[model samples]
Every structure is written in structure tokens, then in C-alpha cells.
Target chain A: AQTIHQWPVAEIKAVGSPLSLGCTIKGKSSPNLYWYWQATGGTLQQLFYSITVGQVESVVQLNLSASRPKDDQFILSTEKLLLSHSGFYLCAWSLTHSQNTLYFGAGTRLSVL
Target chain B: GDQVEQSPSALSLHEGTGSALRCNFTTTMRAVQWFQQNSRGSLINLFYLASGTKENGRLKSTFNSKESYSTLHIRDAQLEDSGTYFCAAINTGNYKYVFGAGTRLKVIA
Candidate 1:
């Protein structure tokens, strides 16, 4: 069975503060990783996706960056946070890019004040 | 305009009752997925369909690529079914998913 883990279940940070969120997948090799953000009472939006290590693709520009440091690890970070950046961050993985089923992690709740 | 449009933004149902949620796409879609965001803010994958229909327990979903739409039907609804349900459609060429605003369902006894 495969499991995805996200760090710091929830966090409250001030505006302009640095932020880093991490996600790690276990029991799967070379899985496609993706980052999604959802605002309160809003739909989810894809932020970035990675097909392999050191290769990341940005879907929407929100002043955030993602990196796949290891085969099973993905990191989302930013130098400064804005009030608009607060939302729920989710990490998902798929076996393949086409006709793939996405599995999501527990998610991390962020609050930027 | 949004590529995907979901209807009935909110629904209230009594236990054991049933209802359906639908998502319509403005463009051709290769596939569609359904998810349930529980109270804890976790997204639970419900179904992924390229075409045809699938059923599991009280949940049944259908994806009609030709029609550019998808539907999720929940029968014998229970209290645990209360949550926000979302539908995501994957574009034909890019494979990028566009999500719906979600329908908030609340099951009352």
C-alpha cells in the first residue's frame, strides 16, 4: 500500500514570513507528484506538478515554488507569505500522467495574517 | 469563463434519501474524477472514469466524455456522507485538471 504524508498539519504565519511545506510518499517509486491549493469555501487549483526528480512544472503563478528533492519527497516553499496565500495545501500522487488516479495526502492548513 | 461548471452548490438531504451531483464541461474532456472533502479538510478520491459508469456501495458515478459531463449519484445517504463534493475534469490534450467549485452536502436525520 502507498501512503502520502504532509508535514505541520496546520500552521499560522505572519505576512512576509518565510514558509516551507513538505510532503513524502512511501511505498511508491517514481510517482508523479502535484501541489494543489484551495481557499476557504473555494475550489482547488493546481499549482505545480513534477514528473521526475529536479523537474517541476508550474501550472499557476502564485509566488510559490516547488521542488522534487528525492524520488518520494516534494517540497513547497516561498520566501515571503501574503494574506492571499493562506489556504489548504494538498499533495497528491499518480501512477502515470495519462488516465491516472490521484491519491491525496491529509493536507496542510495555512493561515497568513 | 470556467471550463467546468457544477450545479446545486448546496444540498440538504434526509438520511436514507438520495440525490445526484453533476459537472458540465465547456470543452472536450479526456477523463473526470470525483472527490469528497471531509470535515477534517482531507480530500478522498471517490472515482476516476475515462468513460462509462462505476458503482461502489451507495455511490455511483458516470463520465460521458462525448457529452462533456459527469455525474455522481449517492443513494441511501448516511450521516457520514455530509461533506463538500468536487468534480475535476482533465482536458483532452494537456491532461491538466479543472475543478468545480464543489457542492456542499449535509445529511440530516
Candidate 2:
């Protein structure tokens, strides 16, 4: 079975602080990775997606960026955090681009103050 | 821009009762997926349909690409069924997903 793991289940950071969130997929190789953000009680917004290592696509520009360092590892980071950046961050994976049944991780809850 | 309009932004059902959640797309989509965001903030995949309908346990879902809409029906609701439900449709051109606002469901005893 495939499993997705996200780091730092929850975090509270001050504005202007650097932030880094990580996600890893186990038992699946070459899976499509995606980053999603959701505000409190709001719909999810796709942030970025990567089909392969070292290449990422940005869906919405929120001053955040993502990188795929390894086949199964994805990282989301920013030089500085903003108060509006606080929300839920989810990591998801799919078997392939055609098979888009996404499986999400537990997610990271961020609070920027 | 593609859009998904979900109906009944909120719903309440007594145990054993049932209800249906619907999503209407503004543009034709290639496929649709349904999810449940639980209290702990984990999104559980309920269904992924390219067309037709599918059922599992007490949950059933249908997606019609030609009509540009989808629906999820939950029967015999239980306490664990209470959560926020979302419908997301994939764009045929880019395969990027457009999500609905969501339907918050509460099951009361």
C-alpha cells in the first residue's frame, strides 16, 4: 500500500519568518505530487504540482514555492511568511497524470501571526 | 477559468437519514472526484468518476460529463458521516482541478 507523510503536523510561526514544510511518499515510485492550500472553512486551492524531479508547476502565485528533491520527496518553502499565509497545507499524490484519483496526506496546519 | 458550483452549502441529517450533494460545472470537465474532510483535517477520497455512477457501502456518486455535473448521495447516515464534503472537477485542457466551495454536513442523533 502507498502512504504519504507530511512533516510538522502543526506549526505557529511569526510573520516574516522562514518556513519549510516537507512531504514524502512511500511505496510508490514516480507519482505525481501536488500542493494544496485551504483557508479556514474555505475551498482548497492548488498551489503547485510536479510531474518529475527538479520540475514544478505553479498554479496560483502566493509567494510560495515547491521543489521535488527526490522521486518521493516534495518540499514547500518560502523565505518569509505572511499573516495571510496561515492555513492548511495538504500534500497529495496520484499514480499518474491520467489516473488522477488523488490521495492526500494528513496535512500541516500553519498559523502565521 | 473553470468553476464548480456545489449546492446546499450546509446540510443536517438525523442518524439513518440520507441526503444528496450536487456540483454543477460551468465548463465540461473530463472527470470529477468527491472527498470528505474529517474533523482532524484529513481528506478522505470518496469517489472518482469519469462517467456513470458508483456505490460503496452507504455512499453513491455519479458524474455526467456531458451534462457537466456530479452528485453524491449518502444513505443511512451515521455520526462518523458528519464532515465537510467537496466536489472537484478536472479540466480537460490542463488536468488541473477546480474545487467546489464544499457542503458541510452534520449528522445528529
DockQ of each: 0.82, 0.84
lDDT of each: 0.93, 0.95
Cα deviation of A76, candidate 1, in Å: 0.5
Enumerate residue pairs that collide in model 1: none
**Once model 2 is optimally superposed onto the true structure by TM-score, how far is the C-alpha of residue A5 displaced, in angstroms?**
0.4
Residue range with the least summed lDDT across 10 consecutive positions in model 1 chain A: A94-103
Best by lDDT: 2
- Each candidate's fnat, listed in order, reads 0.82, 0.75
Residue B65: error of model 2 in Å? 0.4
Which candidate has the highest DockQ of all?
2
Q: After superposition, how far is residue B48 of candidate 2 from its true place, in Å?
A: 0.7
lDDT tens per residue, model 2, A1-113: 99999998999999999999999999999999999999999999999999999999999999999999999999999999999999999999987757689899999999999
Model 1's CAPRI class? high
